[model samples]
Target: MDSTRKYTAEAPPLQEVQQTRGPLVLEFGTSWCGHCRAAQPYINEAFTSGPDLPHHKIEDGKGRPLGRAFRVKQWPTLIFLRDGEEVERLVRPADSASITRAMARIEQN
Candidate 1:
């Protein structure tokens, strides 16, 4: 799977996400979010080394069901999943190290 960079306004249904079978990264935030923008570099850096990882850059806001399903209360929340189950998460990551660590956890699966 490709590592997605652009945030899509459309997100997959919660059920579809839960049914996913491999390592996936769900990033919840909006293009207009300052924290999200600031975190992109580190996010990109991490993904550069994760070519096989499937990533969904979901645009999030009020009334967005996918974000709500994850109980996201902050921008730039990275949820790492293995076999459709959450393994790690980072909120507003400050550097690539933390992001890499979370990615590693999921990549191991």
Candidate 2:
């Protein structure tokens, strides 16, 4: 994985992502999802800050291993985790601003 890019698929391992003080940001959606596709660029941009936190993507729809584990019900849901525990989540985010804001808040906690 490119260190500077937001992941478009499976994110870093949970333990690795939680190693930092900052929270981990995950984009859980498949490539075919329109909303997920749209969110890609912004998700990439969010990583530009490179906040020293882990950023990952798990591209799965229904019935897949990761999808079932996360219990994702919508496309393009952004899940934030702190210390391996879910901290914030936004489904089909209204905009990148909201997603980034959520990340910032989660990182603070």
| CA lDDT of each prediction against the hidden true structure | 0.88, 0.66
Each prediction's total of clashing residue pairs, residues at least 3 apart in sequence or on different chains, is: 0, 1
**Which lDDT tens digits does candidate 2 get at residues 26-73?**
667776678877776666566554355565677666555555666788
Question: Which runs in model 1 stand beyond 4 Å of their true positions?
Answer: 1-4
Across residues 1-109, which tens digit of lDDT does each residue of candidate 1 receive? 3434578999999998899998889999988899999998888888887546888999998999999999999999999988889999899999988888888888887
lDDT: worst 10-residue window of model 1: 1-10
Q: Model 1 misses residue 10 by how many Å?
A: 0.7
lDDT of candidate 1 at residue 20, scale 0 to 100: 95
